[model samples]
Every structure is written in structure tokens, then in C-alpha cells.
Target: MHQETRLLIGQISDTHIRPKGQRYHGVADSNRMLAQAIAHLQGLDRRPDLVLLTGDLVDKGHPDEYAMARELLAELAIPCLVVPGNHDHRDAFRAAFADHAWLPAAGPLHFCVDTHPVRIVALDSTVPGAHHGAIDEAGLDWLHTTLAADRAKPTLVVLHHPPFASGIPYMDGYALRAPERLAQVIGAFDNVERVLCGHVHRLMLRRWAGTVVCSCPSTTTEIALRLQPDARPASFMAPPACMLHLWSAADGMVSHLSTIGDFEGPFDFA
Candidate 1:
């Protein structure tokens, strides 16, 4: 891996940050776990060029929650890109990240970043008062234009909802609505390398839109992976994790799941 040609992007999702001193669902120490995730990123042998935070930034759409999220994110030394999830309030989220020039002043929080080796197109799929996600016609049109603008660069299309169902009936109930609409646009662009998402709270991958769609694991808890139709809704204190995406001109992109916490490792093999 040539250092100059390769770019490492750290992805941490579904942080679900709450007000200071409060835990997510009164079980997971979301704030502390996010801190640990940030520390883990900073301590990596090779630091990421930037970090992408897929959504569910807060448990509730509260200003105080966003405040707590901002405070925790401030610890990150590199630039962070964000998208809104079902739990986020658009107005409050925009206000919290007003400093980011890439964020639009109005409308859905969709934007594109082309400064890095790979292009990033972040879509806002949150429905104001609903847990299910959808991309209206206007959003799809915008995506078409954005993707058309640069067809040669390797791109990443990011959104809060995974476009495909996870087979977990309860979670699938809120999956992206009319995914084929988005797929049609994405399928046309051969430069797109991956579609990144986070609402699932579990790492998932699927082949869609001529590319790979990967959902990041949460920093707080893992939604129980029950695939049965009658399974109950639940979450557990599974080891929190994040994704590391490495891209280079020669290798394209490779993703790795990194667990966040203290674990014994680096033993000498003689």
C-alpha cells in the first residue's frame, strides 16, 4: 500500500448520543462508547484521512442530545461527515453542524465532497416523523445530477437507511422505501464503489445498484440478529465496532470491521 496513494476512511455509526449523564435506552453508555470509538480511531497505526458518521446521532430528536453529540465529536481531530437518521431532527441537526460549509442552508441534508481520492455523496433519507426511510423524487433527481457530474471518480453513496431488507422482520419494517428508485440512478454510475449506511445497528452487506452496500455497526448496542418472522425486538451490549475503508488507485476499496475496546493482541509469533 503506497502511503501517498491510499486513503483510509473511518466510519462510526448509530452513536445515539444522549444528554450528558444519560445513557441510550438507559442501558448503553453511548457517550462513553463514542469517546472510546474516537480514541480508537486516533490510536490507529495509520490515522484515517477523515471520518464518516452514518446516522442515529441521537436517541431522540432533541437539541440537548445534539449538544451532547457535538461535545463528544469535538474530540475527533479529523474532519467528520454526517447524514441524518430517523431519530434526528433536521432543523436541530443542521443547527448543530452549521459550521460545515458543505451542508446546505435549507432543504434535505444531502451534499457531496470531492476533495478526497474517492468522491462522497451523502443522502438524507429520514422521514420527518416516521421511522421508515424514503427518498422523494426531488432527492433522487438531485442524486442523479450529482452522480452525473463526475463519472470517472470512485464514489461512495451514503444514507441513513439500508436500501435492502435485512430479513429481520421488525427492522425491515423501517427499511428504505421504494429502494429501486435510488437503485436505478446508482446502477447507471459505474464509478460508485460502495453505498454506506448505519440505521441497522448491525454490520450488513449486500450487492445492490452495481456496487456493495455496507451498514456500519453501532457504537452503543447491536440490534438482536433474529431473522425469524416472529422474533421480538431487542438489543444487547454487543462489542461496539466501526468500519475502516481503505482506497487506493490500484486496489480500489477494501473495508474492514474494527472492534472498539481494550483487547489483548499483538503477540509475538515465534
Candidate 2:
């Protein structure tokens, strides 16, 4: 398909950026890794039409952390959209990205963007002062209305937490509460392409809500995947990565996981 008919979206999630000069949990350098992810996106052969940050943008819900995140994200030349995560404070997040026109003045950081070939409906699943996620009645109503408004356009629904049980005990403990409720609204729309998420800190995919639910890996650490019910919570300094979703009128969306690091040569098959 022609390039003009395609829309490429770069997705980076769970950055968990901390204040300048500080490390996440006094260990992982989330800030530096985020910078590298931005560089990787910038250096891509086909630059993304836009970028979606699935949340946990900062380690803490502090204003200074948001400031640091803003500084690092400023390096990205592509337009970016964000949704609040468990680690984010709604008010602080709003104040940080106040300049973005798509952000609402108050309430959950929910909004829809129609400027591209595919429509974007970003939902705030973060529940204040909690690690789990949920969408209130109002948010659900808003989502139904928004999706119903543009049923023909391919759409992406962005949220912070995965809407399905990850099978990893620790992570599933804090997964989106009542996913079926959200699914009910999403399953009603056939044009809804994908439900993108972050919180699990690992890449995961499932078919739900009449669409694919893909969770992007964190740019800093990977949540240990232990299916045992008694599995402990742990993270590793694994290879960071990002997701590139390419959509076209003729072909549907195809996602690729791009590892964020300097690797060996890209040799030819011949």
C-alpha cells in the first residue's frame, strides 16, 4: 500500500520516570532509557505519525517527576498522546500537559482524537490512590458515545491497565477491575481495532472485547512472569522495547515489538 494510506503509531509505555538525577527505586535509570526510546523512534526508517504513551509516565505522582518526564518527552518530534496510570495523579498530570489541546480541562484524562486515518479514544482507567484500574459509570457512558459517534473509522482504545487477567499472579492482582464492563462498551463496536495498555511491564496479547488487546512492554524494567499463585513480585533490567502499529485502508493493523537497544548488524539474506 502507498505510504500515504498507512498510519504508523509508536507506543512506549510504563516509563516510570523519576526526578532528574534520581533513579527508579534508586536502581534503574528510567529517565535515560526513555531518552534512548525517543532516539530509537526518531531514527526509525519510517517515522510514526504519532506516539501513544500508555501510562506510568513517572515513578511517583509528584509535580517534579512530571516536569522531568516533560523534559525528556520534549525530545520526541512526533505528536504524542498520553493517559494517566496508577502511578499518576490526575491533577498533576493535567497540569503537566496543560498545553496539549486534546487534554480536557478537568476530570479523567479521557479524550478522542480524529486527526489521523484511525481514531484514538484514550480512556483514564486509573483509580485515585490505588494500584488497580477501573472506569466509572460516566467514563463508560462517554466511551460508548464516543465510539458510537465514529463507527466506520478504525479506532484504537488506549488505557493504562490491561483489561484481562495476565495469569501472572502479582500483576493480575492489580489488573483492571471489572474488565467485562469496559469490554461491554468496546465489544459493541466492530471498528475498534485494539485496546492498548501498559501496567504489566511485559508484552502481552489477547483477544477480547471483539478486538485484540495488546500490552506494550515497559521502557525500563520487565515484570517477572511467574504463573504460580504464590509468585513474588520482582522486576528485571531486561531489554527495553516499544510497539509500532501500522494501519492502512487496504490492510488492517499489524503490530511489531521493536527492542530499544544497539544490536548487531542487519545483514542481507543474500
Q: How many residue pairs clash per model? A: 0, 0
Q: Can you tell me which runs of candidate 2 are displaced by over 4 Å?
A: 1-4
What is each predicted model's overall lDDT from 0 to 1? 0.95, 0.95
**TM-score list, all predictions:** 0.98, 0.98
Consecutive 10-residue window with the lowest summed lDDT within model 2: 1-10
Worst 10 residues of 1 by lDDT: 1-10
- Deviation of model 1 at 43, angstroms: 0.4
lDDT of 2 by residue, 123-144 (tens): 9999999999999999999999
Per-residue error for 231 in candidate 1, Å, reads: 0.8
The global Cα lDDT (0 to 1) of model 2 is 0.95
Q: What is the Cα-based lDDT of residue 148 in candidate 1?
A: 99
